[model samples]
Target: MKRGEAAEDFPPLSPKACILSSRSGSRMNSTELGHRLIRHYPFASESLLNERGIGIYVPPSYYRDENKRYPVLYMHDGQGVFGPNPFSNSSWNVHRTAEELISEGLMEEIIIVGIDNYGQERLNEFAHPLQSSGIPGAPDIICKGESYERFLIEELKPTIDGLFRTLPDREHTALMGSSMGGLVTYNIGFRNPHIFSKLAVMSPYFVRLDLNTLREIPFYKRYPGVNNLALWLDIGEIEANILVEHVRGVVEELIEQGFVFGQNLMYYEVPALRIPRRIGQPECDRRCCFSSGSRAKQLKPSCTAEKKSD
Candidate 1:
């Protein structure tokens, strides 16, 4: 991926979309809608990503502690994280899970930055090795994981750390995503192990699993410091046919490279999830496992934002 201009090159977000919604709402049952609020930033940036949206979730503890610093989890596919997906009309309810986990002391209060995917460019941005398309009007060149990774590590991470009271280190930073988002999460997180210490990839989309792709990663040779990195990789047994075999191959390769289970890696093959396209159940247990590297964790997104209601 090529380097681009600075933040000024991108357009500013819109007022309406950037509306900081109020978190002052009544609580609902866990199965009901997520009670946590989402702060949307429309037109967040188009430099390397889609100039569409950026959603942020702050955990409850953010308001209680003024001097505490927290870890950060960068998630892909912003629209599906907290709000209703226009297509599925369902969300992962990330906020609700975080709230419950934090209250129960099962998870540490952390920040979640949901990076939105571009419409037509979503595949390119999340492409692991620059895949191409057959549809008409599609660009002849069809890969963009590199540029997208740069956007997250170089641009987004810096801005977030500087703004939020965060533990700004690779050990404290994590990546989470499902499907295509999972694909990119694997790409970016592993490629920059020095930048991201943990990852939760759900049903990662890989058309094929090949050793060549694995060889290209430049794994330990580049960043040997994180060989013991924490990873949570999973796939539903009922997942689409294309994902099943590929996930296995990826896992096998990861193991060959010294990623052990229980110590630095966690892999699960379970029943179909509520929203197989996005995440697991609504209990927040899956969310907790993905964020904290421990099956025993969860979080609240209350980050560095000036605690205010919209």
Candidate 2:
């Protein structure tokens, strides 16, 4: 069996069982466990493309109340956002984290929408046309980020807002992802500031393209002010050396362009963990690192790190 294919056969595990297993020796009733499972819409079809659908994760409280409205965060790599799937070697477990945050009152109840990338077209769809230098044969790939963004803003958001009780303003909306997804979220958020006010980018794959001198992204020319937005950026200590340098360069550029610390933009760097060899195969590990960036945020200045074999 493939690494993530097992996710399909296994039913959603009860939160209580998971929690109880973690706790010393506590037992949880089935009814209590059922209540903890969030009301989620799996593979929700996009209005524009009926065949391609994104996963939706609503908080546990969403079903308990009808009048409550919540903030919405749109994330890329739908399969990796919540649990194991074809696209994820190790899931971020976002649902569990969000539930814990809500239970602890660290953050308000919010809705998470995970958008899946077109498997083969993922790289092309996520990259900006101007920045295509680092990617070999990048010209051969069709750049459709413009249309993809439109699908999110013009088609998907409207449908989601109409269906659920959401805080429809930009300030309450956030966009996030890791690797290429991170780069895309940054591109879209900066280009369409009126649509997204918060951005969470992790280990962004900015090296693949060279758009201008790196100092001037076309999006910056439109929205010069960064005060209106909140940004969270992070990277792992160990990854490909080139990719790490690329991420550092992007962060430095953002800082140079008026992204103040703790005010508008926040950056993090997490230490790398040594995984068992069985799960450390090249492709599987790539997704594992990307998924890990979503949950671990320990910011540090760029270090002189050695590169790992790809």
Candidate 2 structure quality by residue, lDDT tens digits, 161-275: 7666788789778888777787788888988889888887767766643445343222111235554667776666666555656666655667677877655666555557222
What's the lDDT for candidate 2?
0.57
Query: If scored against the real structure, what TM-score would every candidate get?
Result: 0.73, 0.68
Q: Candidate 2: which stretches are off by over 4 Å?
A: 1-50, 131-137, 209-227, 273-310
Each candidate: what lDDT? 0.62, 0.57
lDDT minimum window of 10 residues, candidate 1: 1-10
Superposed by TM-score, candidate 2 places the C-alpha of residue 299 at a distance from the truth, in angstroms, of 8.5
Error of 2 at 102 (Å): 1.0
Deviation in Å, model 1, residue 177 alpha carbon: 0.7
